[model samples]
Target: MSWHKHLDTSWFRSDYAAAAMPHDENGCVTGNYWLAWPPYITDDKSDPGSLDKILRRRFKTLEAAMAHVDKAWPLGEETT
Candidate 1:
């Protein structure tokens, strides 16, 4: 099964942000799942261009990541 089957699209702010999740050759989930704000870029906090102001969190599973995003940002919350 594809890793994308695990995702809840409603939790994502946009497609660009959702693309942050890592995938293997078969397009199945590989590593950890992530939740982040707009203009989604690298998960590397050390990345010089990364937006520190935006909220970012990593989780072992997509469910955990979605929960974190819901708790931290919540539905109907305005994002940049």
Candidate 2:
């Protein structure tokens, strides 16, 4: 399998992916799932090129991790 599973991008950035879960020394999925994504970006008329996008999420199961992704990404049904 590839290292990353690419997904759609937001207006700010392109080339985004959930990244495959970390693997053990034996090359197996770990018990925990994790992801890092951008936070909400609010635009200000003064500075048109500024953003605060920092978020980290951890999940006990893959389902939970994907649920988080689903909530943030409701579009692109074909990939879903």
Candidate 3:
């Protein structure tokens, strides 16, 4: 059986939301469930560059992605 799931990433849908691309266990890209935000100047006066400029991390399962997000950005926390 194949495990499939979808995650809601609308909360972080700013100009710096992380990209979430789903992939199968076999390492094949299934679909793009989330769209990354474009590049913009941050308040620190530093350009973090666009999402395209960085290597996007692919997740084989929604749980893995959720864990990564939680670790990177905890709930009820403000992000820059």
Which candidate comes out best when scored by lDDT?
A: 1
lDDT of 2 by residue, 1-80 (tens): 21233322111213243423555676665545544332233354232112322223455554455555556643343222
TM-score of each: 0.40, 0.36, 0.39
Off by over 4 Å in 3: 1-50, 53-55
For all candidates, the clash counts are 0, 0, 0
Question: lDDT for every model?
Answer: 0.46, 0.39, 0.42
State the lDDT of candidate 1 residue by residue for 1-80, as single tens digits.
11233354323443333324655677675655554444334556765225663434455555666554455545555543
Minimal lDDT window, size 10, model 3:
1-10
Global Cα lDDT for candidate 2: 0.39
TM-score for predicted model 1 compared with the true structure: 0.40
Evaluated with TM-score, which candidate comes out highest? 1
- Give the candidate order by descending TM-score: 1, 3, 2
lDDT, candidate 1, residue 45?
A: 70
Give the higher-TM-score candidate: 2 or 3: 3
Model 3 scores a C-alpha lDDT of 0.42
